[model samples]
Target: MDMRALRYFVEVVRQNGFRRASATLHVTQPAISRAIGQLEEEFELNFLVREPRGVCLTPEGDVLYRRASLILQQADSLASELRDLRSMVSGTLRVGLPPMTGSTFFGDVITEFRRQYPGVQLQIIEYGSNQFAGALSDGHVEIAAAMLPIEGEGFLTQTFARERLALLCSRDHRLAARKKVTLRELSDETFVAFTSDFKVNNLIDRLCNQEGFEPSVSGRSSHLDLLVSMVTSGMGVALLPVTVCRGIRSSRLRVVTVIDPVISFDQALVRHRDTYLSRSARAWIEIASEVLGFHVDPVFVA
Candidate 1:
């Protein structure tokens, strides 16, 4: 059967009327009806029932609907892959990155992607997660590494990793050597927090509120390393991802776990829901899944 006819059938089922589907597909009702008639004739079955309200699909039509959706997704990915092989000898991808994981966690993924697609240029823009989400929705970047539980719409996300948020303090601080500390223990401590631009600041505030006190913000910065360094210099303590703390080896700093409802957040590959992803973008996400997880959603290419 023709892919265009299958698409018309799917859209008709989704919109629940041939007329509505015609409007959505920017075709006349006669054209849609003719396509559906051709499909039914080719398959030798009545796949739809007409009523006063609209059209309803038969059992056979439902089966075709599910399979056709996957086939269309596969077709798009294959088409993109072929285009990458033909005309895109070289291409540039603009990516949004949060400052926290931008420097430390993505080294291997970026290096491997570069090794495989040497001709593709990567333009990395560093922003806090909260700010980057807006850029992503506005078509500013192809994809982003975002911290979850993101609060918004018009985004599709696949979780790649989860890490606990650890408390970092100067070695000379009174609680530095402790293996773990409860939230109440640090109730009065001044905090060097990520600004509102970073989602972690919101997480910190929410958790602290649950613990019955608002953390007094002593300093603010978007850079993770800079925030951790501030803690090491005895300005104030900070909460950071454990993976980030592991990347920095400093004898003057201590990394301790937070208890009384342990704090953690997921890291995900995020993009606009309706965006058209390129071959290079899809390839980068696949490589990142290899680095961070066993697999990601394969249908993301569509």
Candidate 2:
């Protein structure tokens, strides 16, 4: 019936009892009960049913709680936007980056952002694709450039670029001089891959298996430089995004195309779906899109 009542109801449902909810909301138990009672009276619907340990939501209560929570979040987001507009800009924008993605893809964007928003602190963290979702959700980073397709209920993603993955080998290796190679062609070769948690690691393995044999993964590292360095050392062949490979200035490492089935990783900028984007973060996103020539629409999760 009222925002206060809705807040009271949601808190009660969250804290599981009137006493705890009142304590959490800094309101009295009677006020909480009175608010819940008023909601029931107004809707003529039983919202909560008693449970042994606490209270459980009735079907109606569950539905109302969901809507009320979303409404409250929207209200808070509106306030944040207004507050940012009124204040002189400056806040930390923690950016999550898959190892080496920043330098290859968003390097110019980051520099341009610094020139425009000198007051904003841009903290760059080198993380792998494996931790993109968790890092965003946990507020470890406000924005991230990750290898897609990254799907999670808590994220909103905008595809910036789709880069091809190629076979990288030491110049001395047997396949190093080839123009292009297929997944099956490299099936038996010992492989240097990103750590097992990375999406690229799984993708390489999956494509290899689809070609009928599992890849022989010999070693793993989370760093792009390390992977190529290992390959140059003749440890094994590696698969890496072309953009990343281009940045590796090494005569000993050869970056060749993947034919047969040209595999690629989609690079996207990911943000937490439910968090309010400060003006600073939004500006960074726009700059990234402009610099990368990526046309994207806001894709949100439920």
Candidate 3:
């Protein structure tokens, strides 16, 4: 019934405990407990089943949790939308980016955005594809840059850039001398892949499947530089964006393009379809388009 109670309930469910949720919300555990107890009493239903480790949600609580999450998301957007009524293009603009995005032209885009909208507080978050998609969908961030074909609905995308994934191998590898290589050729070699949370893994899996072999992964990492380092140390070969590969100055590394079904890495700036675009958000998108040189219409895909 109460917004604060609902938020407390949601955080408890998210953190799977009372103490952690209280810590996260900067409130006392008794406050959260009282809030949840009040919600249950108000609805005349048992919402949670207490456990030693944490707590489990009753069926009623599960249903309320789903609905309350959406309600809170909308409430957050409503406040932001109200703030957008101000004359100045000033407010907090939160944008999510993949960790590897900086190796591309996005740094320049951020610089230009700050130059134009100095009054706006720009909060940049670096998260992998899955994490940021959740952040964007939950209204925690206004816009995000991610690999194209973002899953789920209620989101729209504007194209950023498209480039092939280049193979990075140590100079001692037999394929290092080639300008281009196919996925089939690298089947026998050890692979260094991004962590499972990245959507890039989906592309890698599909390409590897089409090539009739699974990648023999030697290591996994979330950092691009670490992956490149692993390849440099001869730990394994890696597939990286060509834009990122351009910045690698190691002589021991060879950047070769993949072909015979080239693995394309297409990136786009994504935002919720119905979200109110603040002036700051709009300016960031426009600057990204200008920097990336893509003037196309917003792609209505997920």
Candidate 4:
């Protein structure tokens, strides 16, 4: 049996329809149908039942699905292992990172990774912490940086860094005079928050709840610069990473620590435990661990 045909069949089953599988695989629907049809003909059994909404698997199809999945996983592992046997590392490493805080944590790691591994192409996918799990599961990214503790099983993590959340407001604002403030003090202040999909928004929600009042949100944005701009314009105050707030060059904004119950989150490098880690991916983790986690020189490659 053709491995390509097996892949097509598995994708069709996973997607529940030929059209969706075709879209995912970037192949034509007729091509996927032909491949699955060939598989059924080879086995001399009907594997799927055609329906208006989608396709359903027969008992034989279910068995084939389970077995084929293992086979594909093993096949991929074998290929990765063979590649590792080479003396040099040269492959694409796809990594997912949050839009706002990712740069603060990974900018140096990214620079060092590229410098050390010029043969490997690095692909950085921007995803919020909330989306990292799905992105890693879907194979869109091989590894990711996320806020810990990442939910769910079948994943492994290495601690990246820990940081406290700080408050940003216009320099002229009433609370700007203080070097530190608590969530309760800002209970009545208008807030500029991140979009719902960002995990920082979740952090904000929890902090507000702990302080006994909900934030009166006046603006929401995905970009840190825009959020800062909103705060600078006196639209509302924003909560951001202390490091990020400190890096802002604007004299019009105040970066104050949040206390009385300091809001903080741990960051980590996460990946599917079952997925094969290419040399490039391993190198990335090494550099990140050295620079961001251990604060030492990386000796993994040389």
Candidate 3: minimum summed lDDT over ten consecutive residues — where?
Answer: 293-302
- Runs of candidate 2 with Cα error greater than 4 angstroms are 1-85, 296-302
lDDT of each candidate versus the true structure: 0.81, 0.80, 0.85, 0.82
- The full ranking of all candidates by TM-score, starting with the best, is 3, 4, 2, 1
Q: State the lDDT of candidate 3 residue by residue for 1-302, as single tens digits.
A: 79999999988987789999999789999999999999999989998888999989999989998888788878877877788786668888988988876547688998998899998999887788877667776676888988888888888888778867889999999998899887898889899989997888898889898889988998999998899889999999998888888988988999998988888977888888877777788888778778888885745331
Worst 10 residues of 1 by lDDT: 72-81
TM-score of each: 0.71, 0.71, 0.85, 0.75
Runs off by more than 4 Å, candidate 3: 8-58, 296-302
Measured by TM-score, the strongest candidate is 3
RMSD of every prediction: 12.7, 9.3, 3.2, 5.4
Q: Write the per-residue lDDT of candidate 1 for residues 217-240, one digit (tens) a residue.
A: 889987666787789888999888
lDDT for predicted candidate 2 compared with the true structure = 0.80
Q: How accurate is candidate 1 locally (lDDT)?
A: 0.81
Candidate 4 is scored at a TM of 0.75
Q: Write the per-residue lDDT of candidate 4 for residues 1-302, one digit (tens) a residue.
A: 88888888888876789889898889998888888889999999988897898899999998988777667756665676678887568767888988888888889999999899998889897877888886666455778988887777777777667878998999999988898897899999999988887887888898788889988999898888899899999999988888888789998999888998899988878887777777878888878877875532232222
What TM-score would candidate 2 get against the native? 0.71
Task: Compare candidates 2 and 3 on TM-score and give the better one.
Answer: 3
Backbone clashes in model 4, listed as residue pairs: none
